[model samples]
Target: MSSRNSHSVLDLQSLTREQVGRIFSIADGYAGSDVSRLATKGCGKTGALLFFEASTRTRLSFETACARLGVHPLRLDGKAGTSLEKGETLEDTVLNVAAMNPDFLVIRCGDDLDLAALSSQVSMPILNAGWGKKGHPTQALLDAYTVRKYLGTCEKQKILIVGDVRHSRVAASHFELAKVLGYEVALCGPAEFLPEKPSVPVFSSLQEGLSWATVAMALRVQLERHETSYSLKDYRAAYGFTVENLKKLSAKALIMHPGPINQGTEMDSEVLQDPRCKVLPQVTSGVLIRQALIQLNCLEETL
Candidate 1:
């Protein structure tokens, strides 16, 4: 097993199964504790958060987590008031934020390489929220927690990742996490949108891929990144998991998606609302996981 203190989780590929389990345990501790009491006691407060990209769930969760731990969260949303609109470079923005003497810095940026670069320059602990096409470590951590919660253990489990893998940071993170946890990971999508040279198996057809898998992870197709004229109709025909396709999955298989789901584009609305789907739990776990990450990084620095 890899050492837990080795990295700041800029990428999911560096984390081992043991590290994932440890994160869950930490989350459990926070979950069991009384947040109101913690807020009153003010155990250990720290840092600010910087998000250079758009976010919904991640942004809110981190804010809530910091509040629960009595930490002051200073958020930058990249608007008129922020230095970014005034033509400041990413390096300068990060450096200026770090100069606040905050104990930790949580960043959600569009570039994965930039997050890694910023981590090296800063003295404070850095937590990656979501980076472009590379990885979302917190998302992966929560995903593993959800899977383990619903399916006992990940060992020998089969997981099918469908839809757009080529431009999905979530898919990349899931690939590494599933691999570490001993899950049989499979990628299924159109040949053009499929991941290139995946570490595990790849299936051209979603039906074939869903046959032996216990989990189905569907990713949204990023229209902004596409140069070709890829219509929703054509994309759905080739990659979308309709209600009919959902029936083909194993009865025990759980449906998952990293929202906001393009309902008709990547999956049918019915499929998302299916009884076997764990999408809501995934969202809830995201909050818990983000909270745990903040506490862990902050506690590490203090210790």
Candidate 2:
């Protein structure tokens, strides 16, 4: 069952199904327990946060998990005093951090940076916060955890991911990991925004997707990544989850988005407030799942 803890968490691909199951089990425990119980799980341990990209939820979530687990959080802002400003290579910056001997390092950088190469250089565990447009494995983990909370089990649950799939790290991660975690996955978006050949079903419209899904996850339109300007009305007509289209969703279906939501664009305001929306639960589960990741990856223990 591979009970050994992960040496480095670059992506979910390295984790066995049993390891993933154990992580979810631990996270489930944290979700049900009071925050006070997590205070000393990583007592005297330390975690270094190195973010080259701007982030809100991922940065704060990891820091929050560190506090709850008695792990000290040290952040190196890419803009300020970091050596990257002074032409010190990322390799040197990583080397300096690794020399300090922190228990583990958490990082988020642009898509251009090679996380695999960075991991090869560091002896301690390197937890990938977001590796550009390639993947956000932890986000995928919490997402699956959140879905299981609402749907009882992930096995064969229909998960329809809607929006800019090509440039979204979360969407990419979910598309791959959701299948690994046992779900029937599908993608919906303008042809430009989707993969050329998807392993799962590809729906032309959001309405068609919602009709078949138990969970509808909206990916934020990656305007920053797109070179071609898209008409908002045309986008809405084609793929947006307007109130009218949201009505097509089954009553048991859940809605989701990896934060910093573009309220009126991808989905309407009312749908954001809908009880069936699991967005906030996904956020909440992020903290708990990260807590489990920190304990398992940074601390030596037998689960």
Q: Least lDDT summed over 10 consecutive residues: which range in candidate 2?
A: 1-10
- Candidate 2 residue lDDT tens string, 1-303: 123323678777667778889999989888888888778888888999998888888999999999999999989867577668889877678779988988889989886778788677777788889998888989999889988898898888998998888888887787678657778889998998898777778998678889999999888888878898887788877788778888889989899888778878888888878889888888899998889988887786543
lDDT (C-alpha) at residue 87 in model 2: 91
| Residue-by-residue lDDT tens digits, candidate 1, 1-303 | 113233466877676667677789877777678778766323555667787888888888888888887788888885558776888876798899888767678888876348776766777777888887878888878877888888888788888888778888888887777777887778887766776677778987777888878988888888777677577897787668788777678777788987888888888888867888998888888877877776665655421
Error of 2 at 111 (Å): 2.4
Candidate 1's error at 17, in angstroms?
Answer: 2.6
> Which stretches of candidate 1 lie above 4 Å from their native place?
1-7, 40-44, 301-303
**TM-scores for candidates 1 onward, in order:** 0.91, 0.94
Alpha carbon lDDT of each predicted model: 0.77, 0.84
How much is 117 displaced in model 2, in angstroms? 1.7
Highest TM-score model number: 2
For model 1, give the 10-residue run with minimal summed lDDT. 1-10
